[model samples]
Target: MPEDPGLPAGWQADSVDGDAPAEVERLTELLRAHERAARGWASGSEEDVLVEVHGLETRENVVVRDDTGTIRAWGSVHDRAEGRMLYVHIVDRTLADDVATRCSDVLFAWAEAQARQVGAERGLEVQQIDTGAFADDERQHAWLERAGFTCVRTWWQMSRSVEPEEVELVAYPEAWSRDGVEFRLVRREAGGLPDEADLRAVHEVLEGAFTDHFNSAEETFQEFIHRLREDPGHRWDHWWLALVDGEPAGALVGTVSESSQGPDGSYVSYLGVLDTARGRGVAKGLLHTIIADAAARGRDRVGLEVDADSPTGADGLYTAMGWGTKYVTESWHREVPVS
Candidate 1:
């Protein structure tokens, strides 16, 4: 019998454990090459991508190598979405179209199939397959369309360089206090981990705050902490909680990431203030705290991302606070039925 057409020709597929340093380095180089031409990818070192695939658990990380044994692309579905969604990544534009198509199509199809399977396990009502492509990369857009994805939303990738300044420069403490808001880092134990009680408080605040945010979903506490810990720079000290009159009112979670152009600085992975606590400077207070802590640690920048069409006008808040857009990426999603 002839080889299966559903599988790419002259390509061998291997399911990786997603825990190898070699795999991370290979994918990072492949992505960096694509970045040069597309500028659509979020950039970071091998450690960044390494920690990602090797996250809590990945359904699979597929490597596509030509007959010559050259890596043309890398793809993966980090199966952490609790079956509601499958988040995938494929390093496009790094290989010739014929070869890339043969490899990538198979990888993408595998991801979709895996999403359905996982969703079934979780008893989900609908399954979503999520991925991204640069707005300008028609090649990727074309591939996405051919594979059944539709462009839904555009995202702004923004960053800002940080400089040393007095806490007065952030200057929000007094204003926040007047509104009965207080900011403090999550308490740490002698062993250097965040206090369990304080950590749980931060999670509760975020759960309530993003109830109306985009594509919001409930995540188990195990999933939340493990996902963030996968980053190489995650630390207990970087987490903070805001109090309104000594009651937990909000939370901010920041971490450092690898940056090639400058020193690695803090990235706001999550920030939320309860609905009832809005308009009282809790968000501002958290930003000020992050900035002050970054300065204290001698880091050179503080970066964050916001939904461009956010109803809350979050992009405006970040712009006024000194961050600016670096580039853009878009979310392309397609729904699949759980089987």
Candidate 2:
């Protein structure tokens, strides 16, 4: 038997960045290729993915290779959600065929180990790890089952093409508004980065709004801010906040989808409204701001993900506002005990 039976026979795994510059560049290329195969879109330039790799706070990244030393997979357990939840992103192109059984086995073991480590450090009895599979990817679904991840949620990747003429008419019903609610663009510091205080306020609003969300967890200030900054398309001017009676009541962070749609379009990275702000026009107002900005900026469309089963019926709102699901993805999760 191999020293690590979870790995394919004669295959080996190593840290993603344990070597020289050339190796890092090669791994980045591998990552790009793997991502394109998995998601139908290339991840980013080498520099872009490297920035993301370095920004991860508590992560274990690995590259797997066969005996001939050709890299076949990349996997990571990224603790961006502060140990309450870990994200497992793995892509395999091993000769083991469409199943990728060995890669799934090894990657999942690594993720569970990291989950346990972080949960113990945080004094928690359990922590959950999440991973995604395309809704129609049966091979990946089977692999996830073998790794013990239960299919937890389905999400829609929704997008709406926009024209300048319709931006002003996009619906934010006047009746949904309480008096004195308004949307404001986030301002930045001298370097054109979001002012630190404003960024923190956005994070705080998101943390509060998602308290009742499925599998929710608070991403730390540092993690939340830096992880978003790592995106090559990120920009301060794209962020916004909503105010009700001059108090911060909602927040939305939008990023240019340069990798997929270029500067001609943007994605709503996040949208949240305070508990007290719910049932008001805050969420819709924030989304309206995004579409209007896209129109004003000459962008083609705005895109976002919505929980398929959101209690608030967010999907209904998106569809009513002209967004349609371009594709669907599923989240699979497993909880690991600290002990």
Candidate 3:
């Protein structure tokens, strides 16, 4: 690798390899520290850190140091789906904004070069930089805008505290019911992995549910499976599937996040009801089941992210169920022609 021309004096960059123990430890520490300062999430231990670093499709960790050899800033870029899209996570600066910006420029330049290299190897035509910024994070929003990105969509981070007080379950209209509709928690047949048939059904339901949504990328069944498997918090038993007359109609996937740094922090990672199943009790049933499970687990709160402008008005459903917006985040995209 050649030296980055954008790097300011005394700052240096290093590439991290998951196979290298020392590199993993250093990057993990940097990420964990950043999490503590930026978000209330707890930092993962070295072992847990390896899970993320090793699972990424393509990864590059850049560390910036000062003249005194003290670490100043760190950033990582990961490639997903054979190099067509890249996700930037855990970018943090130990120094001030001016110094951080210069370091970030160097890091991004390297990322662009790596993207080009990966694209060439995979025969891809375009490279995408994907990231999300919290609505309250003015600094990050400004940085992203200045870097030529635009906010394209908004997500509401919502949470609801589970209290023992009198609570009533929301019911769907009788006319919304589909014949033979049923709901069940994903169970382990023999081993701990999810049932293949059930998993496929869930994926199908999700695809159908979000078809009309903005920027709904079609995901292959294998890709969906791989994604869940990649998450450190993923637990198969936490998943629920709604069926209409014994066929999958919708699904909700839940996970426990120690990252929340709270006594109650379980999250509903994915929730969807197929188009054919919409307006039925499937969505309500799934939410009820998931919330019950979370409460049973002694979780303090349950949370999920929803598109604020969803055509289906999903955010309203969540709010009606007692969820309140904790924060907002925006997704920005710049589509590049595949050709």
Candidate 4:
């Protein structure tokens, strides 16, 4: 057993500033290689790394380097919500088993420390550290399990190709009404920013919609807006709110996807319909709005992730809407008591 949880003997660990072009390139390459090994494709990019590590206020990152000054592993923790801390773990597959295991220990320890700090700051009794892995990646599964994390859920990463003609086929009126339900983009103010009231409505609708969902936690308005704005692809117009009989009932938040291997796309970052608005076509209407918006923007596809064991049977709806699962991912979580 290693005496130090942070690093093994002869290894050096340091906080990453998320600057230094060479360091960023190396990290991006490491991410790409890992993704390719796990899923047969690479989607990691320099921009993604920057976004993940740059927001030091709400995130912390560390890098493990060998004696040769080569980075062998990377870890990041995001204070995702009041009681949840999101973790990112990446290790070089080329390293020896013992070395890789030690790297995992270091990253896991760092994440646990960050989680506890967040919990203490929020005055919580416990904090959940949430991490994810490719479903088919046995290495990640072993690492997570060995670190006392449990596989909590599986998600289907689904995608649907967009046809240009869909812009004409799908009606995307600014404020359309059907069956007493209205769908429209969140209103903008005179300064070109989204209306505060509309934004709050979207947040409240999502919060209410996910109240009964698995692993749901309370996220403050400030945290919600700050985290979403951190994404490089975030756009004001991609946010849509649904009103059922003039009451906020649902919301859909979409983001642009910049792909290096193919044309850019659109991703449904979030879609939530309040329980009171279920079965009213609110969800379907929101989906159509984003699809039409993607088509108008010439995006090749629209992608979204659905919980495999969702009580709402959302996967079925996505499948029926022409979306197909392209890959699968699993969530792993470990809870630590705040000290």
Candidate 5:
């Protein structure tokens, strides 16, 4: 009797299973390699980098191999309900021609099935699959479009090279001061988390600030905390909070990301000002604080991504601060029912 050929003669698919240490190590190594390759190719982290594949609430990996048993490509699905999102984080095809097409077909089919499973579990009618490709990555973009995804939003990967002398002149806007309003950079205390109350205040400010923006998902307090904790670079000291009339009004959350694909350095992960606080220059003030902090920390550069079409015209603010657009990426969204 001959050995059974899995999925015809030239193709094989396998489901990645088990949480064994070896399995986790293999997945992490694969993910890191994928990330490095993507950064080398695209100048930044892969949009779908899966940092915690083993701990994802819902995930499935499909590996396609050739007749020689060498893995050619893999895909994965991660489902999160807090934001009511189903993210297809991994879809890579190293094979060429029919083999690649076949692998993609199997991958997307698995993703759709996973989405259906999530819907069944949550009693929702539909779920979204969000993906992005570097502006230079036309091939991936084409693959996504051909797979029924559409580009809905674009983001700019912006950066400002650190020059201490240049940054010294980048003063916090003094013209828009509010009486009794104060600004402070968060600092780490011995074995202490950032003041929880201060963090909550910043969360409230962010929620109120971005309410009208595109795909502005309303994050619960817990969700905000969960997200910050998940990031490998999250640091409380890098955060800044603004108070208007002694009340919290705006904030900037900064962190050091290995994802920058540049020198290890601080990045302004988010910058926001509440609607009522916008005209007071709080956003600029917060940004100035973060940039100065990054420079003082000996960081090579400070980077951030912004919606190209932000209503507040944030890109202009960043540009004025010496940041230049390094690259662009488009977000592809598929609408699915909320319920």
Candidate 6:
């Protein structure tokens, strides 16, 4: 049984059953409201909420409801990798400040206990709580600071407008070359599934490419594949590979984006070029391919996130490729010792 997070009188912590329609709807609305407050716009749907909370075996979720049975706060923890856990903290922005702070405290306490539980299950002595906030979200920053999390990094959320003419402007044939580097989509077999060898190559290239990036942690190949597959928009054809001298050297994994107010878009979930192939236009080729593919599919934009402090000047590269900053966010982390 999960431990209870002692809350103020008449408030109680309970587990979230992702299969319940009412539960899903309530959570979705809470998340969207939180985003709307932080960013002036929101993008998540009920489908996104389902993808997040459905994997009960790999995730822990808690919700606080008042005596009136109204949910006012939620906390979810994902055992993302061997040593890392991801946290989602949401409280009703409409509540009074003191009441909201108390609710936030209860959620954070629940999260810490859940973190230790997951850490022990994974046979680790310490676990990291990774969470994010919009750049201008001062309330969230205050909550995180009071909970002992440190602001570690900043990111630029960027997007590029795609036009049908880009399909002619950017060459994305099955096989294309630039500066002695070759780019191609990961091949699919008769079963409509990606080739295992190509999948492994893409994973290896990405694992190597991000080795020196901020907070880099080792994620097993199985974990990588499983996590990516959990996304509702995942598609086999969105995976691309780059080669130099016919050897795997870079990769870009994309996903379809669903929008209620506008045309759907494409998102660059992962993009990396191995150090050995960095200067040969491998990254540029992969970017152009995704933009061209999005245009061909009538997607209006392509979106991605980048480290604000990247030493490689990656944001500059995105800007040069016609991508502009849509918004900014920050990473907040807290390390907890497992009992």
Which candidate number has the best TM-score? 6
TM-score of each: 0.90, 0.86, 0.83, 0.96, 0.81, 0.96
Please list the residue runs of candidate 4 whose C-alpha ends up more than 4 Å from where it truly belongs after superposition. Answer: 1-9
Q: Model 5 over residues 201-270: C-alpha lDDT tens digits? A: 8888888888888877676787677766666678777778888887789888888856444557678887
lDDT of all predictions: 0.74, 0.75, 0.68, 0.89, 0.65, 0.89
Model 6, residue 91: displacement in angstroms? 0.6
Using TM-score as the measure, what is the rank order of every candidate, best first?
6, 4, 1, 2, 3, 5
Better of 2 and 4 by TM-score: 4
lDDT of 6 by residue, 249-270 (tens): 9999999998888899999999
**Can you give the lDDT of residue 263 in candidate 6?**
91
lDDT of 2: 0.75
Residue-by-residue lDDT tens digits, candidate 4, 1-339 = 235654566787777757788889889988998899899899888988998879888988988988777888999889998888999999998988888888888888888888888999999999999999999999999999998999999999999999988876446635577888988999999999999999999899989999989899899999899999989889998999999888999999999999877789999999999988899999998888888888888888999999999989998899999999999999999999998
Model 3, span 1-339: residue lDDT tens: 355556567667765567877666776777676655555554466755665566655555566666766555555555555534544545554667787777666655665666676666668787566667666566666667666677888999899887532122323211123345666766566766667888888888888888777766677888677767777778887777888876788888888776445674578999988777667778877787777666666666788999988878888889898999977778865433334
- Go through the candidates in order and give the clash count of each: 0, 0, 3, 0, 1, 0
| C-alpha RMSD for every candidate | 2.9, 3.8, 4.3, 1.7, 4.9, 1.6
Backbone clash pairs for candidate 4 read none
Q: Which stretches of candidate 1 lie over 4 Å from their true place?
A: 1-9, 17-21, 40-42, 56-59, 92-94, 170-178
Candidate 1 per-residue lDDT over residues 53-77, each given as its tens digit: 6654644566666666656667766
For residue 283, model 4's alpha carbon misses the true position, in angstroms, by 0.5
Please give, for residues 36-79, the per-residue lDDT of candidate 2 as tens digits: 66677664566655664565566567667777776666666666
Residue 145, candidate 5: how far off, in angstroms?
2.0
